[model samples]
Target chain A: MAKVVIEALVARFPGDVYDPYEGAGGDDCAFVQKSKIVEVCRFLKTDPAMAFNMAPYITAVDYLGAEPRFEVVYNLLSTAHNHRIRLRVKVPEADLELESVTTVWRGANWFERYCLDMYGISFRNHPDPRRLFMYDEFVGHPLRKDYPLRGRQPLVPEREVKDIFRGPGPVGRD
Target chain B: MAIEEKGLGERDTGAAPRSAGERPFEGQHRPETYDGPLDAPLGGKQMVVNLGPSHPAMHGVTRAVVALEGETIKEMKLDIGFLHRGFEKSCENVTWGQCFPYTDRLNYVSSIMNNVGFALAVEKLCKLDVPLRSKYLRVATAELHRICDHLTLVAAMGLELGAMTVFLYGVEARDLIYDRLTEICGARLTSNYVRVGGVSRDAPDEWVEKTLQTLDRVTELRDTIDALLTRNRIFMDRTRGTGVMSREDALDFGFTGPCLRASGEPYDVRKSAPYLVYDRIDFDIPVGAHGDNFDRYLMRMEEMRQCDRIVRQCFQQMEPGPIVVEDLRYVLPPKPLVYGTIEGVMAHFKLVMEGIKVPAGEVYSYTEAANGELGFYLVSDGGGRPYKLGLRAPGWPMVAALPHMTKGALLADLVPTYDSINMIGGEVEQ
Candidate 1:
């Protein structure tokens, strides 16, 4: 099933794509270069035969000891074709960045933001590039392999609450 | 001046500006200074209100910073993650068998479905085919959880819109279902009944009869709710045309389950990708046209009936057999055998000591949860614990689309809109 999609992907951008690799449970996965991810994803989504419309999620896996330290994964589902394919982009530890697909799929906004928040892999063209699940003051990406499981950092001092109602008769009156 | 004249004079004065450092009369009030376009239509800036991190209308710990132009919401930003417990990180740390309990907390409303989804993912990775009886039982449990989930969602939506009777009726039916579920699995909300290979135990004695009785009660309650809210002018007025998400936008937002179905798309995982015994069952996928709050409400109500049909069919067709799979590597031996036989004791010891070893692979398994598609993407390096587990929460995308849905809607419309989406905090944050 994935071979057909891979063939189409290869037909369009022959040199930019790699042969489909067997993912877990025999699911087909095709790896593309980090630089060409956005263009490839745009083609995959817009191509007539492969209408991979639904961008279910975008997540990252930290292969701590592997050659490429991180693999950013995008799970795409084609509601029209009823077929699913996973796209993986490998990023080296030193250069932890990839082009964002938010322009292709608006739903990828939060998913990309979450990937940035968890794995500390920056999406180059992401719109709202801020920490999603953690505060801005949080020190490190918690999902990284080097991060300790129970590591805790000191929190910034709590902000003092200002009294909104200063002009008053009795303070508690309605 | 006389009291009546004083009141008239005060009304005439009307927000009069006070002199600097001059104290006004005790009963007089002053308005805040506004610094904006002097020729603005409303003569002031748009009011920015924090709808919640603590507001009642917000079903969970979510904050929507709404910019209001009078009563209408001009723009809104949703801030979630208050309930984030690092569930994925936690899953990576736990063993395969140990992760089952944590799955229950993912979608706590339909927790059994989460367990089923996680189990299916692990089972797929291990290449373990669950037994026929276990499959049927899983379908039955999942459908029951769906009923509970939809009922709670609709009931809560009704309550938020000031319809108390519907809430009571819906919750009452859910309580009966939960009672029966407690009989099957000891827990009510988080029923950790599904194991990796199969269910933990078979149906208790009289389980079939009890389930039938509960189904009857649920049918009656659903009918009551329908009659009360289906055509109720107030209910329709509040929900109809509010929070309308077009089909294209809904698909683009990656909506699934009832919310997506409400947008007139007949995409159901049970039908599209038939997992378990859903392929064999005869049930209809209820869909709606407008994809508004009312349509979502109607979609859930109709889906509940379809769940009842699925549950009835499963109960009738379910053959009496061993619920748990016979794979000793994954399943524990019976208590009697463990106590009596040396082989059983050794098997139990080995099973408990070394959890089922999953192959080096990855799989994405999703179930049609009450709110939407609850997917679990699991990556294993042939170890006891997962290398990485990504939980694709259905509500996360729906919550992301909230600002889109409520942009031009009124402040009162936000409550029903939020409730209609049925965003569970546990599921969203995870």
Candidate 2:
């Protein structure tokens, strides 16, 4: 399945497949242009032989001191081909916006939202762009490299929930 | 135990209160306040529901703030980190070798895979090769671990549906595997067995023989479980069409392992991305056609049977030799050298204190874990500690797709659908 996608990518983008990031043991190994991401992912999903219909999940890596600083990695696997492809988009700390693949893969909705909330990456065309993991009041993305190692920030208070553990006895005296 | 069907109504996290038809897991208890949003639409008709970091159906302490209307969940925003213990940040502070025990907790059930993944990452960083004996030993223990994980999931899925007996049976069988693990390694749950280049120590003769004997017992127990649930009308009916995710849906969501295979795809990482001795071994990848909840259940059962075969094969192909590599830079010196020789003692002390300096490189190593494709993506900056570490947790993807799988289904079906995912806490907490 990845062979077909790589072939198609090479055919369509010419030199894009041999992008600098694809070099062996490179820091930005899986890097691909953010502009062509949605198109490539759509082709991977729709192509009958490489029918990778699910956008399973997206994870972000924070290389704070490294060249690119941030990497938004997508793990796409095809049920049809039983093959997997790791697509990475390297963005500097200054610019984090990437085209959202949710339009092509509906399952990417939550996965991309997570990348946005945790790493503070902006998925440009995300259908519902609200926070997924952190609350609305969260000041910074927790997964960022610059985020404090030992945070002095205020912690979110636990909600006072109904007592689902009540019995006919003292709660904590035992 | 009395099974209470609590219909907490639907709470969606994305939008204004919509009709109940759009919401999933309606009537389910959520965490936090589901009160009308402060920016409620003009008519002010939105009702809030909180699914929690403590709800039973959450699989773990994962909270979700859902907005609802009637019985429909309008939009659901998840609230996690209630179970986060700072594994990644802590790994940076600890010695390189000390991190093995912690990896066991990640996807708690499949400890061996987590251990193997971490060991592989460190091995790549250190450029050390494990002994042939250690490789076979790792495979043997890993296969056993996979069996235990599958059993636990099957039992948990049964218990979810009020089938207490099946849960007990599976738990009992798991106890034997736990005992076997305890015999081999000192601990049962956190078997910090894998070291940087190899294992902590070679498996004792008695332990290996005992594991094979226990496996024989496990086969009988597996057959009983098979007979009980395989064709049971109730089990079949409930799971047949429940949580029907297509092959396309499974792959698009980046599903792997049994979940993807259950959807009729034969993409096992053991075969596709063969590592360790998986390529040398011959085993079949069990697949299902419908990709329903039932297929997931049956696929897991068959996979466990195959794991038994793999374990037997590892034992038959076992070779005796030094388990740890001879490289003093990568692996600590032997016990005699560490205890008697000054250089060996100093090397051990240095490794324990400062940790080994790993070459600057990044690698994504994945193994066929019981749940699915368990991947460890580690980034090293030519330092003693890892610069960035991430896991492509299979459970995260499975749980993320829960809403899509349950959207139109009745609230009662949600529990079984969730159980089929077999998601443990470590991966989802992040």
Candidate 3:
């Protein structure tokens, strides 16, 4: 896996793979430029030896005190070898823009959208950039560290909700 | 106002109309926030149907506003957070020992798995090794939880399809297992028996014998149900070709557990990840060909049989020894020792008051819950409390894949598709 990641890096970026963290079971992860994740991932999936065929999950960690305050981790699995790889990509809390891997793995579309919604991360050229959990009226991201749990917006009036009922018969249960 | 009115489609025209009948409900149909102009780009007319943040058959307070072209869903926008009670944030505020009870509510169907996952995460961060006996007990309770969860799924699906008999039979069988669980732990649903380093207490010898007996009956019932449903003409017609998901599509959508396995992927976490006593247990990871609703249903039934096999294996191979490891720093001193011995009393007091201080480390712990690979990621900043805790819930992934599964399919197939996934809203939102 190290050999594949390293080769993918060298072949694609020539000298972009830097500061590699090689774990047990020959899993190779490197701190590549955030811009190159999409390109690298596309190649990694298509690359004959690597074949990082499945995207298990994608999650972001807030390293508030660290120099790089945010890190996105991707867990990838290969059905061919039944091996797993953990890829870490670091980004600053201030500038959390990273390329979306939706082009490479369609499974990442919702996850990337969720990360964007909750953590206020920016995904460049995402297919559908919409808030996931929060409503259209919600102003700020809910999952960010600085975002307060309490809301500033006033609750919707009961009168407003009552107006929306238009069915003839009893709606739901009587 | 209460008034006497004659029947035959209301003969109250002579009497004054009630105040409630005079009001007309009318309002502007505009969203609270508008980002841009509502102009279409050469598209067909779209009607919207909102499927609840609070509606029946949503499982919980989850809503999806789906745009439809006639009866077909053109696009869907999922609205969540009705059940987000900040359980993860609460995990930080509570003591390590106190958090076990809270984990019970995350996936209420499979509380034992949640306990095991949360405890395992903390244990890994603290670098605490559980005793061999503790491992066996964890496996037993976890598998039992799996059986119960799968039973609920099958029964719920049966109910949705108007198979009231199947639903009742499934629940009756599950109740027997729940009774066994109650014997082992005082609580049936919210069994916070899994402690950080070990279980809350050792299972009584008679309780184990009873559980084994209950499992024997449960296996028989599961086989009977499988036989009843697998070849039934109506069951096959209703489920066999309904909500089919291709293997490629299933993988692309991140579908796991029986949903993924039904598409012919053998990615069981017990076999692949090998956590707890799973490495020692002998069981098969069942897979299906068509990835249809029936295949998903049948796979879960087969899985219950495997669970029975695993529980029996635990009982036969489990050695009688100390269930809790002798790590006083992590595991609390025994109750008898705490009451009788002075040193043990102080140890227990300190553990209770100050809480166990896990070292500064981040670890991702994965356990095969009833749903799928339920993972708990804990980051501790060398403090007594966790800096951040994230639960990798399986329900949301299945929910996220709903659009893919339901698209181009009949609107009526929606219930069967949703029920087969058995997504508990708390599991997704939390």
Candidate 4:
């Protein structure tokens, strides 16, 4: 069932897309070149036959020792066609930036921000490139494999609340 | 004059109708302080107001910074993650089976659904078929949780929107279900009752009968709340045209579940890709036409009725069989067999020491959760610990689109809009 979608994509971007891997659950996944990802996404959305309209989830996985340290994943769904495709783009650690697909699908806005916050993979030209989950003062991308599970972070002093009923009292240190 | 004509309870929602994208929230910001005369006339600028990371009216720990021009909202920026405990990071470090307790907290309101979703994803990766009876149980329990989730949404929505009776009725019905669920899973909330291959236990003989009786009372309460809010003039006037998201925008913003269905998209995960025994069950997906708050409320009401029908049918169609899958690698052997047989002891030891061995691959399993499509994108590296567990919390996208939805609507309208989205911060912030 997913083979037909991959065939359509291959026919369209024969030069750009390669290494189509069929997942164990029969979901078709194809890796697109980082440079042409947004173009591929635009085509996928606008094309009638492959109208992958909704971008449900976009996340990143970091391989600590691998050549391309991070892989950004886009899980695209098409309600019109009742199908979904997984799009992957590998990014090297040195150059951890890729074109954002928020323009292709507005829903990708927060997910891209999340990827940036968690994996330190920047999305170029993102409308709002602020961290989605972590605070602005957060030191590192917490989701990276290198980040320790119980790593200590610098905490700011609690602000003095003068007119509050139940205040955040002083941190007791003898 | 218009306010005097209809008063607060009956003011038309479309009194100040603005076009789709006409600088509603775009390019609107509170200006920097001005150095004017001490008694100078007031500069009519949009006032910035912050609502809850801990405010009483807020459903969860989320902060919305809104720029208000008069009573209408000119812009809104949502600051989430106050409740994020790094669900994906924790799940990645833990064993596949150990992840259930963590998934249980993702949407703590309907934790069983999260367990079911994760289990389904792992089962898909392992290519294991769940037992028929367990499938029925999963569907039934999931629907029950769906009702709980909707009840929470409706109750909170009512409490904020000046309908205290609706909140009371909704919570009472939800409590009745929770009592039965406690009997089944030994917990009121966060039931980690689903395992890799199947569920934790079967429904007791009388459990089905008790649940059926509870459903009748729930139906009565639901109908009462429906009567109170469905046609109430104030509820209609407040919600009729505010928070209007069009069909195109809803799809474009990746809305799913009841909210998506309310926007006229009949794309239910259960109906689109029937997993479990949903194919055999007789039920309908109630789709809404208007993409407004009232329609969203109505969608939940109708979907609850559908959920009731589904639960009843699952019990009737269920056949007597082993509740858990026979796969020893995934399921723990019964205590009697574990103490008696050497094979059982070996299986139990191996399973306890080293979790179920799932083949290395990735699968994005989605289910029709109470809020919408709850998806878990899991990548396994042929090990006990998962490589990556990307949680697609259904509320994430909905909360992301809040600014867009409430761009030009009144600040008061934000309550119902937030309620209808049903943004459970445990899942959304995670």
Candidate 5:
């Protein structure tokens, strides 16, 4: 299933997709150029043989030290074909943006917003690009590799209560 | 939904009177007729009502900024994340094994499913296959959790819709199942019963017979509730046509599980991509034609029956064996082995101090979670902890489609619609 799709993809869009091959996990994977992501997704969704209709999950993994610092992964599924394709788009730290694929699949709406809120990788033309999980007052992307796990950024001022349980945080409580 | 560009406060431009015997709207298709919003706007002005993060009847912390033209919802904007505790960020800092408890909290109603889903993902990364007995046990427990989840949905649906007896029946059935679950996992709400390679424990003696009795009672109660609400005049009137979605629109919105199935799509992860012992089971996926709240309710009710069948088959087909895999690296050694041999002691010490070292790769594993498709995309870097864990929550798409579903529908219909979506805040927000 993956080989057929990959071969067709490479034949159609010669310069856009990179490293088109089945991943070690048996999923058809391709690292597409960031700029042509929407085009690729639209083509995949509309293509008869590889009708990847649903963009079920989309996430960005922060490779903090790598040259292209972030990898935005799109897990696409075609209920018609019963096959899945994972598309990864590399984004540099300098340009933390990618064109939105909302036009192709409406389901990518919140996933893109979640990516923006959690990883700080903004979608260029998302209709409602507000933070999906975190508050507007949130300081930084919480899911980034550099974001300290113990970092406490509260929405409200803390109040002094009795000693709870001892655990890891900015201020230890016992 | 090509809705009018008019503000909620703006007067209704649609003056066409409604035709009798006309059908309720479907999909995101905005109705053209100016149906009176609760007997035509009270003062000819649209009212904006905020349904809450704190209000009763809301299954979880979710806020919908609804613009009401009378009682008809003109537009809606959802403000969520009140229950968000950074599930992804928290799990990334913990060991792969520690993440089980975290996943358990994702869908607290049927937490075993979340645990199983995450465990399957990790097992995929490790390329480890669990024992046949373990697979059967996983299927049995997961099916029981499915019954519990559907029971919760039906109970809440009935309670919110003014059928209090149905809620009581639903809860009664659920309590029996939870008691059976507690006997096995030692926890009620969050059962962290799954490990990387297999399940954490085996079933207690006579547990199968007791569970069968519980399931019989549950089926009885479910039948009563079904009779009470499925065809009842009030329940049918409210849910039969309200919250309808077109087949194409549902797919476009990335709906999975019952919602997608209720939308006339016969796509079920269990049937399409069988995992665990699902391929061995013979069951049917209930498909709805109307794609409305009633269909979704019926879908869950029928699925509970199917779950009963799956669990019974599991108990009958399963044979006693080691629950976890024999892999010393992934599974902890038995108590006797740890105290008897130096090799076992070393393996136990290493396994406890340092978690299972999964090969560095990524895998997207999905399961037929109660609400929809609960997917876990795990990225490993050959470390004790996971590189990234992205949750594709089943209820997220349904919640996102609230505005679209309620457009031009009556205010009273929103309750059943919301209830039918079965949005568990833990998973959706996380």
Candidate 6:
């Protein structure tokens, strides 16, 4: 079943697909260029022959010394066909950016934000491209290989509390 | 804060020179310069209020800033991450087998399910097959945890909405289930009972009997809740048509479990992609006509019954045998063997020193968790520790779609709507 879907995908986009390996647990995994992710994903989601409706998640793995330092993975499942496929996009450290797939599946919004928050990978054209899990003031990506496990930072300053019983600004009357 | 005072004669002299078409004050003369309460706007406009980062109805530290025009909510924005503990980052540092305890914190209400999910993901990566008895036992434990989770959620939702009796009954039933869990495993709340290959311990002699008694109690409680809330005018008025999510919208938001089933899509991971002995089980998938808070509540009630049936069948079919795999590489040797033989001691030492080494690959394992599809995307570089671990919590997307659910609903409807979704703080923020 996976071979049929992979073959169909390869026939449509020849140069984009490469080194299709049967995943460790029997799913078919194909490596594709980062540039073609959005297009390929849209096809896989909407194509009549291979309609992969549910996108379980989008995550990235950082390979410290490899040429392409990161591999962004998307796990797509076809609810209609009851089959699964994995798409891995090699993302170099220097250019750690990929097109956003929120337009294809609205569920991808937070998953993409998580990838950016953990791996320092940016997604172009994301509707709300703010940090999801980390606070606005958090420093470096904590999930990177170089980040120290016990690294700590100073706490954010607390805001002053207002007096609830008092009416407006200053207490004294003019 | 200084209070602005009106002039001494302002109250009596309020009737200013009337314009051509202006009407006089109705009865009593009103003060010309009057300021309303501090929180309300002076002019008639939408009021902005923060619901909670620590309120009881929020389940945990989750804040929702709601904009209201009178009693109706005009806009809502969910602010999360107050409970973020960097679970994925922690997994990167821990050994493969050591991550099980951490999974317990994800969905504390159903900690055993999270443990099972992580164990299954690691087992898939290692290409290890668990024993048949263990398979049935896993299903039994997972289903038991599912019922407990649903009971807690229903109880909390009821308590938030002033149903004291329902809360007491639900918690009582859940505590009974916990007693059984404590017998099977050592702990009740965070039962790290699942390992890479199999369960940590076998069931006690009276475990099945106790489970059957608890199932009866839970069913009776479910009936009481159904009679109390299903057709009651107040409960129906408050929950029906509130936070209505259509099938398309539910799918677009990546809903699963009873919530998605209530939306009329039978895309259960157990049915679509059977992992354990689910393929052999016979049960009906209950769905709802209108995906509203009421539908979600009723769907969970029906699911608990289905889970009870699954547990009964598991005990009927399960046969006595080895609980863990026979492979010495994955499963730990018995204590007698370890103290009696030199090879057993060496094996124990190696197992403790070096955790199970997974192959260099990736697999995405998802289960029909209490809330929805709880997925674990694991990437292993042939090391004792995982290269990367991503948890696809169902609550994450549910929290993301909260604004959509509460857009134009009444402000008071927010609690029931949010509670119906069952957004766990640990899972969402992780």
Tens digit of lDDT per residue, candidate 4, span B300-394?
88888999999999989998998887878888999988999998999998887777888988888888888888898888888888989999999
TM-score for each predicted model, relative to the true structure: 0.90, 0.83, 0.84, 0.90, 0.91, 0.89
After superposing candidate 1, which stretches have Cα over 4 Å from the reference?
A159-174, B1-41, B340-343
Cα lDDT of candidate 1 equals 0.83
**Model 3 agreement with the true structure over B318-397: per-residue lDDT tens digits:** 99888777877887887899999998998898788878888875666667777776777676776666777777787767
Global lDDT of each model? 0.83, 0.73, 0.75, 0.85, 0.86, 0.82
Report candidate 4's fraction of native contacts. Answer: 0.70
Give the per-residue lDDT of model 3 (tens digit) for A1-174.
Answer: 345556556666755556656533234556666767787778778877777777767777777678788777777766666656666788887788999988877778777877887678879888878766665566776655666766577675443232123333454534
Model 2 Cα lDDT, one tens digit per residue, A114-166: 77877888899787898765667779886676777775668788854433333
Compute the lDDT for candidate 4.
0.85
lDDT ranking from best candidate downward: 5, 4, 1, 6, 3, 2
Worst 10 residues of 3 chain A by lDDT: A159-168
True contacts kept of 5: 0.60
Better of 1 and 4 by TM-score: 4
What is the overall TM-score of model 2 with all chains considered together?
A: 0.83
Instruction: Assess chain B of each prediction and give its TM-score.
Output: 0.89, 0.86, 0.86, 0.90, 0.91, 0.89
Task: Compare candidates 1 and 3 on TM-score and give the better one.
Answer: 1
Q: B116-229 in candidate 5: lDDT tens per residue?
A: 899988887787889999899889998899999999999999999899999999999998999999999999888999998889889999999999999889988988887687
Docking model 5 quality class: acceptable
lDDT of 1 at A11: 77
Query: Candidate 3: interface RMSD in Å?
Result: 3.8
Q: What share of the true interface contacts does candidate 1 keep?
A: 0.60
Candidate 3 runs further than 4 Å off: A1-16, A22-30, A148-153, A156-174, B1-46, B336-346
